[model samples]
Target chain A: MIRIDAADDPRVAAFTRIRERDLTSRDGCFIAEGEVVLTGLLQRSSFLIQAVLLAERHEQRLGAAVQAATAAPVYLAGQQTLDGIAGFPLHRGVLALCRKPEPVSAADLLGTAPADAVVACAFGLSNHDNIGGLFRNAAAFGAHAVLLDGRCGDPFYRKAIRVSAGAALTTPHAVVEDELDLIAGLKSAGFRLLALSPAGRSSLRQVRPAGRVALLLGAEGPGLSDAVMSRAETVRIEMAPGVDSLNVATAAAVALHHLSGRVEA
Target chain B: MIRIDAADDPRVAAFTRIRERDLTSRDGCFIAEGEVVLTGLLQRSSFLIQAVLLAERHEQRLGAAVQAATAAPVYLAGQQTLDGIAGFPLHRGVLALCRKPEPVSAADLLGTAPADAVVACAFGLSNHDNIGGLFRNAAAFGAHAVLLDGRCGDPFYRKAIRVSAGAALTTPHAVVEDELDLIAGLKSAGFRLLALSPAGRSSLRQVRPAGRVALLLGAEGPGLSDAVMSRAETVRIEMAPGVDSLNVATAAAVALHHLSGRVEA
Candidate 1:
């Protein structure tokens, strides 16, 4: 472990001005914050851990995780220095810089799936929290993979990773070029496409999961485009009257739980 | 309608420095932002609407909602003035100050629920977003009411109400003194109590909804206290081996959806 006293230390340049880097380009590197996410980076993520920065106070509690990351250089700093490096009051006090994995094709993600696989697909999901929540739900429900359209936010983004409880690092995912490409690819892969929308023709309870199922989720407001919904079997959660819909991520959890196929006891 | 050109205008003081106000005291009045929440305030809430503030541009779009709030005066200002008053960019261009309704007891909320009702109860939920999401799920799944322990965050906070999609205003809710009181009340009301926890003895699918059901939820990490879970029948969502649990709000959504008692097609 190396000690980083100065916030401007060259060895820790990748961790500097984190809030700014979150918005701008990061040169193919992404930041994962908090101990849970850092553990995910060390253990679950397929990507290389570029480095790990932690507050000195957390070293005792997180020493095991740092030791487990044999390949990554561990940098420890005081809370003030760590906050300075992050450009914010990072109460969690653990952060990691990891390399982004090489891009995988959507076909490859679905081609190797098990016959009874469940995969989650998102289109135009701009909110990172929603993206993270989707991944968390997907992981909890034992989804084989996640596929996102080009318009969806990056699940590897800092907040997204934190909100996902590190599921973004562990879950296998591919970003398709667009909704049309995703639909065509899923159909070609022999996956039953189920789109979630308020105007869905089928209630969620009606859709019997058969073979491979690809559940499609859209953004909260505009939802799945008409063109996309027309191609997939649209399903809606029966809701109380006067209410329009559930949050995209919450809805995903409900649908994923049901589709997980746990027979009622 | 009132026209306010100055940011410091006393008539609109309640709407000034909203981000700060969110953290500090509000003198019994809460701020609701965005056009959607404003509509909830004007139409669904039992609380009295004290005033409404809008960017002049939204006047054309939200004029009907403003007009419907017969007892509240509407304040119109330019975008710059509105932003300055808010101490941030108020992109939604709509805000309202509404009086908080008088507090209701857990007994009263439970007493009013129908014999076959499904009510959601939250314990030690300190996060406003989770509280808001719970309310939204309760409303979406046709829950009759929501019961929150004293430790839960105020659902009327600006962000909570927004995150709830304005369900915080429309949904009937009560803050009980503590978890013990809430448990006793639900049992006395002849409601089947189900507590959601990772260590639950019963799987979610096993519990058949019989009559009035009260689903208990706790915070994400610690979850419901052991004492609270002991009194209620513990149920767990079947999950993948490695995952610990779903987000609190997402779990509530799944449980509420199942307990809503929809028949499969």
Candidate 2:
């Protein structure tokens, strides 16, 4: 175990940009924290261990992770110094920065995906928490994969990752450059392109189609662009009168629950 | 038109604490903002208008509100001073400190509430944004009222009001001292009390209850207290595989939609 209590350590630079989208532009990349999320990352073996930053008190707990590593530099810092470097208060004393995962191809996602995959097709969502919450909902309801559309923020952003509780790492997703093409692609694969809108003609629960079903959503305000709405099947979630619409993430949860056939009538 | 450019002016104190709670000791007072929400307050005429703070630029736009006679103080401030006092950029410059509405009896709520009213029955939720978001969802989903358990934070907190986009003022809620008693009261009154649980046995969409239904939810972490759950009907939202539970606010939105009967198959 290496112990150093310096806030200006060059090694800790990667953990600093977590609040911003540019997470550690160094060669060694990817950042995740918390025991629950870090366990999943380590179990998946997606990234090579670059360094482990932890408090002096947690040396034993963090040592376990470092001992199993093949090769990487380890830095130990005090609580205040660690907090200074991370730019936020972290509950779990451990943090890991590993190489980013290889980007998945659209074909890879499609080739491996099923016909009736409960999916969230995200478009124009900027809030990291919303994106994270969407993924968390997706994971809870048994979605096959999450497909990202244009104008959406990076899913790997620290805030999004924490809000998602690290499901961003475990859940499968394909980032498509063209939102229209992604919807069309899903439809061609026999997946029902279900768009959630206040003005949708049909209730989300009533629209029962065969095979793969993709729950289409957009940012809170300007929900599903007119073009996207025109291309996909329109569905409204029946709400009590006066209520306008649900948050994109919340709607995703409800849809996932319904699509998963888990709702016990 | 009145314009004062001092951050320390006593008038904007309540507005300044919009996101920060527990800083003031004065009871029976909460904050409200925006033209729609402020207008709704004017229409209800239930609470005292402690003070109305307006931006000089919005003098003509907010003329009608200022013209109303309610006995509350009307204070004006410039943009720079307002920004410094509030500590955050506000979309709308108008703010009002109104008296807390009289607490409603559970009996009255059940009897008068719409048969299909969507009520966000909160238990132990502390986040102002979550509370506000729940109110916003409740309002947007056409919920008739919000029944907050005493353990929950005050909805009149500036952050809560702002998070709800001023919908906090639009909705009606009866704060109860004992949540179990309220849950029982809801049950005895023939209101279906459906508790939101991630491990719920049934999906909300599959719930086919007739007459008055109350969508019951607890705080984000240890959702719906055990006592409340034991007394109320337990139901879950089906979600994608491996995803964690949705955020409290997001969950509320989904549940509100599901209970509103808009997602019926």
Candidate 3:
């Protein structure tokens, strides 16, 4: 590990103006914070490691991870310097800058799954927190992969990564151009498409899966588009009157747990 | 409706310094923001209304409700004046100050629930977001009431109310002194207490809940305390390998949906 004294050093330049950089910045790399997320980034062979910047105190705990990132530059700084460089308090004191992997196609992600696999798919899900929670639920329920429509937020966003508890790094995911293409791809892959909505014809408790299943979800307010819902068998979670519906991510978790439990059984 | 020009007027003093005054200075009243939450606060007969402060634009849409709150004072102000009074931009352009209802004992809450009812109980759930999500799930799954131990955050907090989609206002809830007393009260009421944990003895799918069931949930990381788990029959949600457990609120949703379905059946 190389010790750095100045926050403005050229080697640590990528870590500056984090919040501002989050929106209008792209250098083919994303920042993963916290030890668990860093560990996730390290485990994945698909993404190339660019560098790791951590506080001096975190060296002993993250020694093994730093050793593994030998090819990438490792910079060590005091908490103040690290915070200054990050444009925010570095409470976790660990960050990894990693190169993005080559984009995978929708066909490629769905084709590799088992015959009875369960996959989580999203449409127009722009909220990072919802996306992150969706990924975490997807991982917990053993979904084969997460399929995202183009309108969905980037799963690799820092908040999404932190909220997913690093599941965004580990889970196999891909973004496709059109929601229709995703539906057609899932259908052709011999999977049953179940669209989740408040007005679905059948209750989730009564669903009897055939073989493979793809759970389709939408954003909080508008829900799934008619074109997409028309392509899939609609299912609803029974809810009390007056309240509109469950939060999108919470709904996704319940649906995933149910479908995955059925598939595993 | 009364129109006021000054931001520091005593009539609108309860709305000032909202973020800072949230913790230390509550005088048996809380601020309810947004149109939906205001609607919820207006609908509840138990909570006494102090006054309603709304932007002039919303005066027409909320005219009927404002008229219904005849006993309480109604104040109108311009968007700038509302923003200045709130110490933040009042985009939703609505706020309500209501008196907290008299504390209800845990026994009273459980006693009022139906014989075959399902209740969501919490211990040490301090996060407002989780608390809000739990209430939403409880409402959606037809839970009779949400029982919170002393350690849980105030469900009536503004962020919690908004996050719950106003479920916090509509659902029957009570904060008790002791977690154990809450559990004991449920048992004596002929309700089966089911503690949710990752290391539970039986998978949730295998359990056929009897008459009344109270689903006990804790915070995300620490989970249910040993004292609570030992006293109740522990049940687990079967998840994929490697991942630890689902978020506490998400777990509550799945369990509540499962038990509510069984109870209804």
Candidate 4:
């Protein structure tokens, strides 16, 4: 591990002002914060680890994980210097920069999915926390892949990655530019699409998943468009009177739990 | 409505430096921000409304709701003055101070629950977002009430109330000081205690809600304690291998969806 004595060290410059960088593009790279996410970068993700930055105190505990990333150089700095480089408090004490995987098409992802797979599709979901929660739920419920329309927030956003508990790194996903194209791709793939909405004709319990299924979720206030709902089997969760709907991510978990096929057995 | 041009107007003292006040005690009061929560405070909550503060622009949009809270006086200020008083930009342009509801015992809440009821119980959940998510899920699934152990975060905190989508204002909840007593109360009240844990012996699909059911959820990392699991029917959602568990609130949503009796029909 190389010691970084100065926050402005040329080798560690990429790690500086992280909060500001999160708002802009990272070229082809993304930041993974906290020990859990760092571990995911080194161990689970297929992405290339560009480098690993660690606070001096965390080196002892995180050394093994860093060592496993033989191709990436490890940079160590004191807590003060690390905080200066991050432009914020370094509570997690570990960060890693990784190359984003090459982009894939929605058709390619659905074409390669398992015969009886479950997938999550998001539309107009702009919240990073919701994006992260969707990935976490997809991972837990064994969804084959996640498909997001262009309007959804980046799953690799630093906060989204942390909120996802690093599932963003391991989960296979693709961002489709057009909603209509994504819908057509799912239909051609012979996947049953279930769009969640408060105005659905059938309740969640009434629908039976016969084969491969895809659950479509939209933003909280403005639900799935009529065009999207018209093509798919629209379903709604039975909620208490006067309540509009569940949080987008919470609704995804409940729907995925029922459609996962794990419940059938 | 009273016009207040100064940020330091004594009539709006309780609304000043809200972010700072959030860290300290309100002496049996809580702040509800955003128009949605403010409407909930005025129309839904049983708690008394102490006052309402609004930016001049919001008066036209929120006038009807504020008028309904006849007992509480409304104070209007310019956006600049409102921001100065809040110590931050007030994007939602609305805020309210509400008296906390009188503390109810776990026994009292359980005793009053409907014969066919679903209740969510939380243990050691210290995160405000998780606490809020739990209430939102409980409300979405038609759970009759929510019970949090003393270790959980206050649901009435500003962020919690907002994240709960104002469900915290409408949901009946009680914070029990002791987990054991809460468990005993559920049992004596003839409620089934289903402790959600990763190591649970039965999958969530195996359980059927007969009468009154209470779903017990713990924090994310350190889940329900062994002692608590021993007395309850430990249940788990079947997940993909290598995943620890879903977020606490997501888990509650899935479990409550199953046990809520809404699905049984």
Candidate 5:
């Protein structure tokens, strides 16, 4: 590992703006922190690695993973300096800079999944943590793909990536520019569009999936706007009467679990 | 609404120590920000109100709720002073001080609910925010109660309460001294004991509730310590083959939504 003593070293500067770098995607890249997440990225299909930053004291903590990397820049910093630079007190000894996976074309993603697969379409969920959590659920429950309609925060945003526990890196997803085109395409593909709502006549359990299913989810409040709701019929989760609905991310998980679990022998 | 100008006013000091409040006792209080959660708390039968703090700038946003508070202290502060005292800039013009509901004794909680009741029993989930999210799901899918076993965090802890959006106020729950006693008690009460597990023979859907059911959940990672696991039969949510598990809170919501719907219908 290359060693550095100054916080301002150009090598560490990119790591310093890790949050902002992922937030704005100025360099079209984001940083992954902690050894597990970094290793996850390293093992995944051909993601571009920009660099690796670690504490000199942590070389043993990350030795195996570092040796596997062929060309990524590897640098060592003092514990205090690394902590000061990463901002979060617990950096877990390793962080990596990787090129953001190019957003998939809506056309390409729609074509590959099975005709009866369950896909999660998230809208207006600007909260990075929620988006990440959604992705984690999407991955765990076997969503064929997750799409972020316009106005949702980038699922690859740094905080979202971390909250997803590195699942965002493995889960196949795309952000499409045209909302209507994407929805129409799903319909053309024979997917039964089910929108999650608190007021549906029937809860999710009653809505059996017939073909490909695209579950449309929106932010917690101002839930799936009327414009979007009008596109797909509203569906409810049979809740015990009189409490507010689940958080968007949590709601997405249940929906994925519900939709996927159906027809599993 | 009574107006005050200083951040140091003792009248609002209870609001100030919010982040540090003791959450162990039934009467210990917590803060609920934003109007939606405040409205949820107002209508639910579970919590007692302790105080209401409002920003003078947003008095118009809370006139109705404040006018209804008969005896609870209503302290008003300027936006700047409110920000200073709150330790974070909060735009939610209204904040409600809510007393923790007296926890239903484990015996009473299990005794009263239907044999099919889907209860979430948390063992040693120490993070307040995760506990808060758990309560939010518990509230959403109609968990009969959230029982904090001996090792769990206080769900009434300030951060937990705030994160739960005040659902802790309306969700019937208790922190029992002994989990084994409750487990034995519930079994005798005819409640099916299902512990969520990554390794299990039965999918959650296949395990029909036999009257009242208590779902035993544990903290994320090192899930359901071996001792607790042995007490209950294992139940797994059928998942994507590669995926091992869902977040505990997410898994709780999935289980509650699926099981509660069966009973609610």
Candidate 6:
């Protein structure tokens, strides 16, 4: 373990102004915050860790993870220096700079999945919280993968990773260039594409999946585009009259839960 | 419409330091933000509105609700004045202070529900986001009322109200002193009490509700107290192993969707 005494120390350049980096770019590396996320990052073999920065107080609490961090240099800093390095309060007190996995094509993600896998595909999911929640739900329901169209936010973004409770790190996901093309790829792979919307001929409770299924979700407002809805079977959650549709994440939770049940049946 | 020119106008006292007032005290009045929430508040017969403050620009857009506000006075102010009054930049540019509805006892809330009603009972739910999501789910699924123990946060709080998409205004809810006693009342009201827990014995997909049903949810961590869960029939959502349980609000959504389907059947 090495001690980081100064905030401007080049060793901690990646951790400076975390929020600005979050909005602009992480380059090829993603920042994982909090003990839970850092622990997950250390355990995963898919991502390579460049370094780990932790508040001095959390050193003992995260001893196991630090000991097993292999060759990654562990830097411990005082609370003030840590906050300066992060450009924020740094409440969670731990951060990890990780090398993002190599880019994998949407087709490759689908090609590698098992026959009865359940995957969540998002179209224009710009909200980070919604993206994180969807990944958390997908992981909770044992989904094989998550696919996002170009417009969706990065799940590896700081807030998205935190909101996902580290599930984004464990879940296999890829971003495709075109949404309609991704839908077509799923259809070609023998996966049933189920488009979830407020307007649909089928109720969610009544629909049953037979084999590999891909749940297609859209943004909260201006729901699934007509072109996308027309290409797949549409299913709606039967909500009380006059009520707006469920939040995208909550709806995905219900759909993932329902689809996961089919695999067991 | 009454024109309010000054930021310090006494009539707009409710609009001052809204974020601070939101935390310290709203007294018997709650601040509703945005056009959607204000619309719900204006239409509700149970609560009386004291005043409506709108940016000069929104007058044309909200013409009907503003014109038909009856006895309630509508105040118009410049965007800058509204922001100064709110102690923050008001993006929605609309605010309403409505008198909180008369408190109803847990017994009274359950008594008024129909024999087949679905009520969401929350125990120790202090987080506003979770409380808001639960209300939204309850409203979406046509639940009759929501009951909360004293440990829960006020649903009428500004952030909760907004997060609920104004469902907190439309849905009937009551808070009780004793959680255990509330559970007992639910039993006597001919309602099948289902305690939702991660370690529950029965899977949610297999559970069937016959008559009046109460879905009991607890706070995110340190789940429902043993004293409460021991009394109600325990039910769980089948999830992928190693993944943490669904967020409390998401769990409630899945549960409400399942129980509401029984009412239709």
Cα lDDT computed for each candidate against the true fold:
0.88, 0.74, 0.86, 0.88, 0.76, 0.88
Worst 10 residues of 6 chain B by lDDT: B40-49
Candidate 4 lDDT for residue A132: 95
- Give per-residue lDDT, candidate 5, residue B56: 83
Which candidate tops DockQ? 1
lDDT of 4 at A146: 94
Better-scoring candidate (DockQ), 1 or 5: 1
* Model 6 CA lDDT for position B195: 94
Q: Please give, for residues B88-109, the per-residue lDDT of candidate 2 as tens digits.
A: 6766887777887777776787
Predicted candidate 4 versus true structure: per-residue lDDT over B154-246, tens digit per residue: 999999999898988889999888988888889999998899999998989888788899899999889988889999999988998888789
Please give me the DockQ of candidate 2 compared with the native complex. Answer: 0.59
lDDT of 1 by residue, B1-265 (tens): 7889999999999898899879987888898888888776667662468888988987776865677656678899999999999999988999988898888777888888887899999999999989989988999988989998889999989989998989988888998876898888899999999999989999887778977999999999999998998898999999998898999999999998899854332
Say what the RMSD of model 6 is: 1.7
List TM-scores for all candidates, in order. Answer: 0.97, 0.87, 0.95, 0.97, 0.93, 0.96
Candidate 1, residue A218: the lDDT equals: 91
| Candidate 3: docking tier | high
Considering only chain B, report the TM-score of model 3. Answer: 0.94
Compute the lDDT of residue A29 as modeled in candidate 6.
Answer: 90
Candidate with the larger TM-score of 2 and 6: 6
Error of 4 at B155 (Å): 1.2
Tell me the interface RMSD of every candidate, in Å: 0.5, 2.5, 0.7, 0.7, 1.2, 0.6
lDDT agreement of model 1 with the native: 0.88
DockQ of each: 0.94, 0.59, 0.86, 0.90, 0.79, 0.90
Off by over 4 Å in 6: A45-47
lDDT tens digits by residue: candidate 1, A49-147 = 888898888777575566765567889999999998889997989988889888788889899998989999999998999999999999999999999
Supply candidate 6's per-residue lDDT for A142.
94
Clashing pairs in 4: none
Candidate 2: stretches off by over 4 Å: A17-28, A45-49, A62-74, A262-265, B10-22, B34-48, B63-76, B91-94, B114-118, B201-206, B262-265
Lowest summed lDDT across 10 adjacent residues in model 2 chain A is found at: A19-28
